[model samples]
Target chain A: SAVISQKPSRDICQRGTSLTIQCQVDSQVTMMFWYRQQPGQSLTLIATANQGSEATYESGFVIDKFPISRPNLTFSTLTVSNMSPEDSSIYLCSVARDGTYEQYFGPGTRLTVT
Target chain B: QQPVQSPQAVILREGEDAVINCSSSKALYSVHWYRQKHGEAPVFLMILLKGGEQKGHDKISASFNEKKQQSSLYLTASQLSYSGTYFCGTETPGGSNYKLTFGKGTLLTVNP
Candidate 1:
């Protein structure tokens, strides 16, 4: 099992502002992932954050909108740029632990863009 | 591709049991189960790899049917804490890639 934490448990921001959510893991892990969850909706994958290379985004997401940075093994950040009301959702970070098949998730950063 | 889960919602009483099913259109290398409480992130429950291995956590257990290309999460003796949305994520067969296509979700409400 892995312990993951995210910054800014909840926040409200202006429509055009940007927020960077930080994710930290207690132990070094492989394959960090970012996700988005709208109210009453399921989790949607945003991208896969690689340490040294560009992140691999999902079909409906782009780097300009949700930029990711994985500078090291234990930390990563996801930035929601120029947020809109539609982007008001819970952003979560997940990491797959080594030597195990489970993926642990951070508490989540709940952002309400108005 | 994403796996399909059944029973969009379900209501159960304390101590009752419920089963959530997840099936994929494509063959899966592994299936992962998670539960998300309201206003929180999804918590990892268990993972079932190919070869019919089963794992359990407390009263919750899951089985993977490799031949059927499906997996089922069984919540036995469910408590109010079990009330949450359940999601099944599928990992396709390939190399060491760590991508999981998740299902929509199954909302479970456990009442007293």
Candidate 2:
């Protein structure tokens, strides 16, 4: 397991604005991911952030909507662009252990778009 | 595709036992179990890899039947702390690691 922390633990933003969530891991990790959990819903993977390459996003999630930046192995960011009321959800950052199958998740960023 | 979880909700009393089931329509390479409490991030409980050994910790255990594309999570001697939503994430063959298709969560409420 890894210690992960996300910045701006909680935020309320206007519908057409944007908010960037940051995730930092305790040490270098190879796999970092962003997920969204809507109220009363399961987690939806946004993208996979590799240290040196562009993120691989899942279907229905576009880079323009949720752009990701993985500057290094220990840090990454996710920007929810042109937010909407539907964008209100808990954004979580997770990391797969260096060699294990289990993943550790950050506390999460609670974003509420009005 | 997303897997299906049974008993969308279950209520258990302390010391009781509960079983949560997860099944996929497609073949799976692995199954992951996670528990999430309200207002908190989901925590990994364990991962069951295909052709690998079944896993358990203390009072919690799980099994995967690769042939059936199904997995079950068993909680023995339930505790109040076990009250939360449980999710099973499935990875099909050739799927990327850490990229899972999650099932609709099963709500487990363990009352003291």
Candidate 3:
């Protein structure tokens, strides 16, 4: 299991502002992903943070809204751009080790837009 | 597509048992289970591959039926610490193997 941590554990932001969440893993990993959990909703995959390339986003989610960057194997960032009240959710980052079937998650970033 | 989990919510008493089911419409390569406490990230429980295997940890066991495109998690002799929301993440073939589509979790509350 990998030890994952996210910055800005909880934050309150004004509408129209952008906030970037950072995920850092203690050890190097091959796969990193970003997920969102709305209030009382299931976890939704926002994108796959590919190393040195653009992230693969799921339907209903675009890069313009949730841009992600994976600079290296142990670190990644997800930026919630032009945020709105509806964008408030707990953003999580997860990492998967090579040859393993489990993915470990970070202590999610809870964002509240006012 | 996202997997569907049954028994949206259930309550179990100590020493009792319960089962949670997850079903997908498409063929699945794997099914992963996780348990999340309130305000915490989901913790990995177990993973079942495509070969129709059953795995367990302590009193928690799970079975995967590739033909039925479904999986079931069984908790025997429930403990109070078992109270949490359970989620099943499904992985399909022909895409990023690591990408997982999660189901709308099942809430389990084990009472004394």
Candidate 4:
């Protein structure tokens, strides 16, 4: 199992502002993913942050809107640019350890756009 | 595409049993189960790979029918701690096999 943590556990940001959430893992991981859970909705994948290269984003999510950076195997960051009320949701980061089939998640960063 | 989960919500008493089903239109290589409490991150439950496998952890178990592109999670003798939203993530045959496409989720409420 992997232990993951995210910064800015909860925040209230004004519309048009930006918030960057940081994810760190206790151990090195090959894959790290960012997800968003809206109110009364299931989790949606934002992008997969790779250690050295560009992140792979899912459809409906663009790199310009949700930029990601993974400088190393143990750390990554996601920036939600020009947020709107619709962007208000719980953002979570998950990591898949080197030899594990299961992916563990961080506590999550709850964002409320006002 | 996202998988579909049945019985959007369910209420159960302690020691009771419950089953949540997940189905997809596309062929699946694996099915992963996870549970998330209110305001908490999802926790991994179990993963059932292809070849029609059944995996279990503690009082929880899951079966994947690769041919049917469906999976079911069984919670036996459920405890209060079992109350949470359960999600089933499906992995397709190719392309980003490690990435999971999650279902809408089934909310399970266990009361003492």
* TM-score sort, best first: 3, 4, 2, 1
* Candidate 1 lDDT, B1-112, residue by residue in tens: 8799988899999999999999988888899999988877788888898658898999999999988899999999999999999999999887355788889999999999
For lDDT, candidate 1 versus 2, the one ahead is 2
TM-score of each predicted structure versus truth: 0.94, 0.96, 0.97, 0.97
Of the true interface contacts, what fraction does each candidate have? Answer: 0.73, 0.83, 0.90, 0.73
Cα deviation of A81 in candidate 3 (Å)? 0.7
lDDT of 2 by residue, A1-114 (tens): 789999999999999999999999989998898999986789998999978878999989999999999999999999999999999999999998766657789999999999
User: Model 4, B4-112: lDDT tens per residue?
Assistant: 9988999999999999999999999889999999988999998888658998899999999988889999999999999999999988887953788899999999999
Which docking category, incorrect, acceptable, medium or high, applies to candidate 3? high
Estimate how well candidate 1 is docked, as a DockQ score: 0.79
Give per-residue CA lDDT, model 1, range A37-72, as digits (tens). Answer: 887887788998867778999888999999899989
Error of 3 at A79 (Å): 0.6
Complex DockQ per candidate: 0.79, 0.86, 0.92, 0.86
Model 4: lDDT to the true structure: 0.91
Mind giving the per-residue lDDT tens digits that candidate 4 earns over A1-114?
A: 888999999999999999999999998888999999985689899998868778999989999999999999999999999999999999999987665568899999999999
Q: In CAPRI terms, where does candidate 4 land?
A: high
**Candidate 2 docking classification:** high
Model 2, residue A42: C-alpha shift (Å): 0.3
| Per-candidate count of clashing residue pairs (backbone under 3 Å) | 0, 0, 0, 0
Q: What is the TM-score of chain B in candidate 2?
A: 0.94
Worst 10 residues of 2 chain B by lDDT: B93-102
Local error of candidate 4 at A83, Å? 1.3
Interface RMSD list for the candidates: 0.9, 0.8, 0.5, 0.6
